[model samples]
Target: MNAYDLVRGLHILAVIAWMAGMLFLPRLYAYDAEQNAKPEPLKSEMQALLRTWQTRLLRIILNPAMILALIFGVWLFWLRSGQGADWSFAHQPWMITKLIGVVLLFGWHGFLAGQRKKIAAGTSKYSGRFWRMTNEIPFVLAIIMVLSVTTEWTLR
Candidate 1:
């Protein structure tokens, strides 16, 4: 394998790690919401545990993975450009679509981070059902991104 292959592999791995956290975090939030409805020590204990898990997942896995994925993904784009790949939106609509999806994923990550802060503060307003519904966002975005890359779909 060559440099491009290596970078692409790393990008994929990092995205996989990021996606794992993206998919799991909201489910954790749902459980946290459920726990919030309980009473006494159990509520406090579960909230603390969930908060710890969310914090660790965000700080340890999600953040690093996202950074690495973005770095390697940009590297791959630069390498592709160097290799004479056309990056024009008209020429590669799929790349544009993939980019939009990635941007949305980044936004979702930020949203989750903000929610984590609210949860830690015991000020979160979202319900378990809300989190459950939002959990599908990453999965749907992943499918769109994968199809965009694999198919190289165009507007025409």
Candidate 2:
């Protein structure tokens, strides 16, 4: 309807896209790690295919989606501020919480990228179990963020 509404929609869409890759990539890593125990050409073939998928997911989906989400999210925040929404941490603890969650998500994205590089380089020390456990990070963060926004959770 309005510009704020449009930006908010874009932000949500981008976040969904980002989350898809965030959730799926770790599973791919888990499979790749597990493949190390398999024999010969099968292991090599699976790793190569997984690596390709990882690279494309990161480059084509994750990176652009994250950047767009950040941009649109900031736009929404600016629009809200223009409409006199309180953004200060003291006045809007939920906003601060959401922002912190976003930062953590970004950090997780970076960590995954680093892990992908290590995996490609044949130097990753992480196990399939580790990757599987860590795959829940984004989902947990999303719950906190969504609740913060929907509840307007605050100290006051």
Candidate 3:
């Protein structure tokens, strides 16, 4: 239909891809951690495989999806602001709240990238349980962001 609709659709798809990658990556980390406690050729082989999986997912899908999602998300935010003529909508507390969640989500992504590096290098500092816990971050942020965008809490 419209350009906004198209951009929004693409943004949603990118988010799906990005979230899927985020969900799966930490499992890879957990698996890597498990493999690390093993011995010899199996350990090395599993580590190499997990490293390859993590790197490819990060560089090939996750990073690009994140960039696209950000671009489209920003575009949608700007679109909602209605050019430069209107500023009232942008001042909504819900908008600010949503943005904070987004910022935190991005920070989580950065943290994952660092973790990826450590896991790949076999120098990860945390346990598999740590990664398992961190995997819930996106879900929490998603809930907050969805509520912020969908409900008129500020308008009430």
Candidate 4:
């Protein structure tokens, strides 16, 4: 009911939403990639997959989740220090690791979109090798996030 509790709740909720999206989306990509590899014709299936994931879910769900995650995170950080200029944040090893993970996640999302776009137009061949290979990206990013969250180890 208090300000700290409210922000803390929002922060936890946002992290759950964001982590769910990040963790599951990669698996979805794996499913989509396999489904795409089956003899269904690459162009049409690729187009459909790209539109649904890259355009629809990525834009509507993932994008907003990232923003909400960031907002709630900033709110939590502010609550911790009571100031936007809090240098103590830099001293927090977990926050630093999380920040790096977030950066990788952001780049991975954009990279997914770019790959989808490239293969969507039929200009580039829809290669299963390419899809399967790059699909490891989100997983790696997610692991960094997991370690960031659950580890007591410190870099600072």
Candidate 2 ranges beyond 4 A from true positions: 83-91
**Residues 42-139 of candidate 1: C-alpha lDDT, one tens digit per residue:** 99998889999999999999999999999998888888887556656435888988999999999999999999999999899999999999998998
Task: Give the candidate order by descending lDDT.
Answer: 2, 1, 3, 4
Model 4 per-residue lDDT tens digits across residues 18-123: 6566555555555555555456577466648645774566567667877887888777778777766666755678778877877887787676657556544544
- How far out, in Å, is residue 141 in model 2? 0.1
> lDDT (CA) for every model shown?
0.92, 0.93, 0.85, 0.65
Clashing pairs in 2: none
TM-score of 3: 0.94
Model 3 weakest 10-residue run by lDDT: 80-89
Using TM-score as the yardstick, the better of models 1 and 2 is 2
- In model 1, what lDDT does residue 19 have? 97
In lDDT terms, which candidate is top? 2
lDDT score, candidate 1, position 141: 97
> Candidate 2 versus the native: TM-score?
0.94
lDDT of 3 by residue, 1-156 (tens): 987888889989999998888888888888888886798899999889889999999999889989999999988877766755676767788788888988997998899899888776667798888888888888888888888878847765
- Model 2, position 6, has a per-residue lDDT of 95
Any runs in candidate 4 off by more than 4 Å, and if so which? 24-50, 123-126, 129-143, 146-156
lDDT of 4 at 100: 86
